[model samples]
Target chain A: MRSDAVLNEAVRGPSGPRKHRMLPSWVATTALLLPTYAWLTLAVLLPLLTMFVFSFMSATPMGKAPITFTLKHYRAFIDQPYLLNIGWTSLVIGFWTTLLCAIFGFLAAVALARATVGRMRETLLILILLPFWTNGLVRVFSWTMVLRENGFLDNVLHMVSADTGSISFLYTRYAIVLGLVHGYLPYMILTCYIALVTIDDAIIEAAASLGARWWTILFRILIPMAAPGLISGAVLTFVPVIGSFMEPRILGGKVGVTMGTVIEDQFTQAFNWPLGAALSFTLLAVVLAIFATFSGVLRRGAAA
Target chain B: MNNITRRNTLQLMSAGLIAGAGYSMFPRKAAAAGTITVLNWQGYGTDEAWSIKAFQESTGIEVVHDYYSSEAEMLTKLRTNPGAYDLVVLNAARCAQAMAEDLIAPIDYSKVPNISSVAENLRANENFNKDGKGYAVPWVWGLTALAMREGLPKADSYAVLGDPAYKNRVALQDDAVGVIAAAALLTGQDMNNPKDLDLVKETLKGFKPNVKLLWSTEDQWNKSFAAKEFDVAMYWSGGSVRSKRVSKLPVDFVVPKEGGIGWVDGLGIPASAPNAEGAHAFANWMIDPKFYVEWATKAGAPASSNVAAMEALPADDLSRQIHKPEYIATMSIMSALPDDRREAFNNLWQEVKAFYAE
Candidate 1:
């Protein structure tokens, strides 16, 4: 047939060039695309697959990697009451920290967006955002030095105590939360500012003429409009804060061990990488669930 | 000097030629032999005094050193794909566990005659050479003791943490061994008995009321203690010496009359190593009394295997160190207990963590 003649001609061509002609453009394009996909596959996907595989594995006697796969690690987590308790503890910390960051961030952003002439606002804004300019570890270290009883705050406290009798403020849960909020507050503020700066002043004026009180207008219109920003800010703040390793580590000391430290120990010094991976996966799953729920609600709210 | 001249010439050539030809043939006398890598703790090296610089100078066999922070971390490395490393430095307690699993090889002391100079007290330590044969050289030893801030109520023992005067001002090592040892010491129970897990749990809970902080990292220890965040800190001898070096305040290192953690970390070659000759040469050089004392002075970690070396240390405050021979005699060498005991430790550790986390 004519097809056989064409195949014969293709085969008859020099073998090196003929091989290239056999493949389609899409196939070549796919081959060209493969290195990038391969890089991601080797670097990210393979490890994630290993994590998924080992969540079903067990810790060996020598405290090395899992030699056999079983659901024991996951089952171990489910059966343990303390694990459930830790999960709840993480949720509580995440929810409260997010709430505080969102509230403070929204107010601060609005104040920054609306307040004073150009340079003053710029200077004040820089001062507000300066802490974020440092690495998170350094910032947390700065807080540790600041909040300790022997630190700068304590020096002030000692000056006060010299007048009074004494005071103690370190190693409380208050310090840990305070550290996390300060660390993550800037992101929340940025998110809120991006949302707030675009709103027309006329919206407020319209609400005012419609006989709505300022609080009512804020509650009914402003807050609802800013809801997306608030939600995004919550996600931004809570995700890192909840999974924090260093902040709670340095600041929390004895008074801390959120899900973050648990996961960290499982990997670094514990030699239980698989277990650590599982713990991280657990944290990630929770984060993803929150994101999904937030997005779902946002889509519905936007449609409304 | 001739080899050095050739090496300089090789350096000037193209990088590829240096890698391929000139350098390998030039070191015909010594560099013909390959390298020996030592995996040890950070403080084990001798840059200031207790460093490997002298050994390298004496032997001419290139020595490379790397460090790990914890015994568990070191064990993990040794167990899973021990890279080109020929030797590891580890505490005998951990070594017992590692050797039982055959992760490391027994050291032939005849190959390291300098090991014969290790103190008799150290030689007799059952933890290091339980079967009367040596697979390791006693490189260094130290204790975990309590260091307290000045002008605080006299903390003669760890039990003082429970004293109402020190409430909300106590720090404990966040490690399982330190935690358990402190518990055993405070409870007036037999320290070596390996009692029921619940008993250990109850004893540790008492210390919980006063201990506001638990430190796991060396940096955390240095910063927290220096800041005087706690009135009393349970600390290792190594960190205490370093803190004492730069501290403006008068810090007191105390080995409680009750007892403390005494440990001996030894240098041993892994069985899988091909360069046993290099390992032996390095081990012999390390156990020299002069070398041992040298590192202790510079690194601020006093050595346990060398009494003569300790006596030889010229640091004026060496006398102030809590490493009294009599006190060290009272200290029991820590050993890795059975698998069940480790599990018991973890279980109790979780309980302690839960109490504090809440």
Candidate 2:
């Protein structure tokens, strides 16, 4: 309460502080903040705070947490190398997902915007978004069925092998990439779509009338124009995908470990909240850094 | 939040805790009783509606249950302005923490009339009840057993998973405990002895090279396997049994002659539970023989702790899902161990994985 008054005074000026005069306003206007603050506090702040507190506290003898405060958990998190490896894996997953999403999204957006068709254009665009209607879990589950050993892909391989000689597929890092691409590929497409949809068809037609080759226009104007959306979509997809536990948990099988799994295990099974929190925050920091970097890149790309 | 900000908040909590009676501020139960909210990790308790539905129908309590994928999430909700949940179900080790932190209240058994009906061994189980008096009640317990395609069956054990012939055809449960334990058992390291990092590593190295994939859930994994995904894998003993029955596959499970890890989950009342009476009613209702029997009949994991509950189960399922009482007594249950030991296993397990994943 006192801090609130002080903040108000700092903004409004001390002269009319008591009167609450027409001085300055809040950093975020109240109407704007009501929803935003609630969202952040509930979804982000409180969870992060709890993770931080649990990090300081000792894990119960069962390797979880006790209310008792201790630094032993932080020490444990720092000391372990296996958990550290998970951080590296998380980065790899995030980077690759973003890169892939950017490529596929860019190409799809190009086709959607420039390709001339009446009903077909709208229909093709709608088809691209059809996967979004399904829940994320459903999409991931579908992939598991398709890729599991002796699953559709594996059976296909086996069928081919029966005719030829050998076969295998499923639950490899390759399986994980297939899942990641499936999961975030839509975000990329959506982002790139926004950029492409905004462009006037005349600009491309005008460039084409000047006798520019199709590939030349895509490389020069269309790509530069849509680069912002492509990067923005990559940012959206990559930032969270970096910390994703599910795609890997379900598809990576035993072969995958990302920081998300490590942080999760620390809190749930390991009972070392501090270490989990520390690890979580470590992952959080990495995500934020990338998020910031991407935001910077997109801003500059928009300008460029 | 930034590190400094997080540190300040934790410092405040720690200072506040020390200044008061060292327990967390358990939210007082509500007076007039609105909805009794229950939060649980996903896939816990009886399958979908099993844990809460019975309580709602029988007691006329309007219960709202939310599922979380992690305990940190549940703890986050409780720690920051708790008053949302009336009761929570957590493992025994967590019950001790919650109780000490004052995040949970000791279960007043007198209020829960049906508690004594819980099986005798579980009543005094180390994780659920710190004292003989109840604070948390055991929900479901089973050993970490391996399941395999039964068509090529001989007497089965963990060693079958390591057989080079089965390499890339076998799957293991993709969890730290199951992975480490399976590896340790094959290596002849004590499952209970979480220390012996080197042996665990060596054992997991042997097992990992043979393992095809690790699984996190029964739903997709089983469907894939039923459709001939991975030939065999480590599975929840109960689920594996159910899967075999439903798939009508030649799938069989071994308690593992070398040994297996046993796990148990308990339901506890959070200190901040909004409806103590309702929560008690719910907990009591959850453990009933009738309830346990339904879960066992449909779910395959029999609640053997309750003799009456066991009686309610089909005679054949009792023979199959849970072994005989004498065998149950000898069965080793998975316990929460200290970090150094657990991490030691995690480190070794990761090494083995890196080798195999390579």
Candidate 3:
């Protein structure tokens, strides 16, 4: 708080020769922020407020039907017992996806930071980010080609063995996890890379000089420094994965009823907007709680 | 000061040309009486570029189109924007709902002479006719049924989908209404409003061992089939046609002894249609034998409701071969569902899907 106050004073400039001709700093800041606030109010806040109102309604305000305010939609988890299972399934999927991404991504980031430098490091970083250039739906669909029965993987397996049955694991929860990890791994890598790259090489050399083995150095030194990045990456990944419908719907086949798909069904298939809004708010609350839990780590990561 | 140089002259000329081009590209405002707006699914019959051009050439009225992705969206568009749409395409199941909401007006069958050629069953379908007043003109119709791999024994019933012999080799549609309707038919109950939903649920649950995929889109179904995902699946008649004829997948559509789940789409004018006369004229043209033939042969469309239009197709046409008139009698046409029943179906389907995941 003291540092923040000092920074604010520094930004406002040394108050010693206040120019009467110039507008106040607060006015300038407000003027600069007004357009952004207006845009947010128009685009995000208004729609969210509308949906909040809708969530409390008994029915969608359509045709000539009179709408009444009701809280039945919020009782969805209790009223519909099956939703609890679906919500749990979504969390499980999110947990696995986030775990896999952190494992593979952190290792990749460490490799990029320590093993490569100059042009090679630049090239590796670009390669890591290449997935973001393509459409996410296209990437998920392509995984089907690689993972389906008698697909690229099975064919390769058949090439090695004369008589091998198909070993495809497509249309399963594993496939859903694989698709999500592939989609989110780049985010984990980028975050960890940013955090890891900032570490002074002298610190690592000093640990080596102290006769610490590679694993010890990694565990005691690098991991501690990179904890913020890992937390931020996990939060980023878990939040979206829980809400993702496309990866599960495409890869999971019959077993893809997540909270995302359930909410989508209310809006698109069932036309139960009130229920959809209620579910969305419930999901938002869950997401906000997650953010609150990780707020400290996220702030520290930003500071780093 | 008029100091006109060669560069300035050239710039002015190019600017004038660009302005002229932009002006020409902008759609001219036609007299309200001469223009009619239609609301339907994108790339459906109404918005076909060739057909719309032909329609404009034949009739003085111009055709513009707005699209809705879902039935609820169509109703919402109608409710919110009065006089915005002259005509809308509604499934027979949704016609009653639209009429109940007073979103659509009663059709004057006399104005649509070609509607006479529409198949008697479709023309007299109770979903479009209420209180002896026709709300919509039956346009095109199809069924949701089984599509099986070629060389497999022809499926004679929906029971074949639950056969454990094809374990992990059967696909089901990922829709509540269609899936429940199929299950209802399997359990010997009314597809629209089944009395024994428990039996229907049990029947669907029994298929879990054989259920490999619950496909939502035709493209996904085709890709999965091509990758040898499933041999037998619940698929659309129109999709089966496109699969065999266009995609060249080895699949045959079979309407079982119990019957396929039938759906009919009709053209209805909005209650507040600004140009009701033009809407009627366009509606008549849509059902016309000539227009139906062109659309079916060239663009690939659902079977026409007009018997004469069906007859106009060549003897060997796949659409004609598959969409048999006799099937209409055995089929169970979908009807408008009450909100509670609709919610129940959605909940049941979600539960069954969750069970599948388990």
**lDDT agreement with native, every candidate:** 0.69, 0.65, 0.86
Q: Please write out the lDDT profile of model 2 over residues B281-327, one tens digit for every residue.
A: 76766677766665455433434455556666677773344444434
For TM-score, the strongest prediction is 3
TM-score of every candidate relative to the true structure: 0.77, 0.66, 0.83
Tens-place lDDT per residue, model 3, B159-266, is: 999987789999998889999999999888999899988888888989999999998777788999988889999988877877888789999889999998998889
Q: What ranking emerges by DockQ with the best candidate at the front?
A: 3, 1, 2
lDDT by residue (tens digit), candidate 3, A1-304: 9999999989988765666679888999999999999999999999999999999987777755689999999999998888889998998999999999999999999999999989999998898788789999999999899999998899999999959898898888999999999999998998899889989999999999999999999889887788778888998999889989999999888887799888888887787899999998998898888778978867876664
Sequence-dependent TM-score of model 2: 0.66
Worst 10 residues of 3 chain A by lDDT: A12-21
Q: DockQ for candidate 2, please give it.
A: 0.18
TM-score of model number 2, chain B: 0.71
Question: For residues A102-175, could you state the per-residue lDDT of candidate 2 as single tens digits?
Answer: 88878887777767478988798789888778998888878877765455665677765766432334567766
Question: Which is superior by TM-score, 2 or 3?
Answer: 3
Q: Return the TM-score for chain B, candidate 1.
A: 0.73
lDDT of 2 at B64: 77
**Candidate 2 CAPRI assessment class:** incorrect
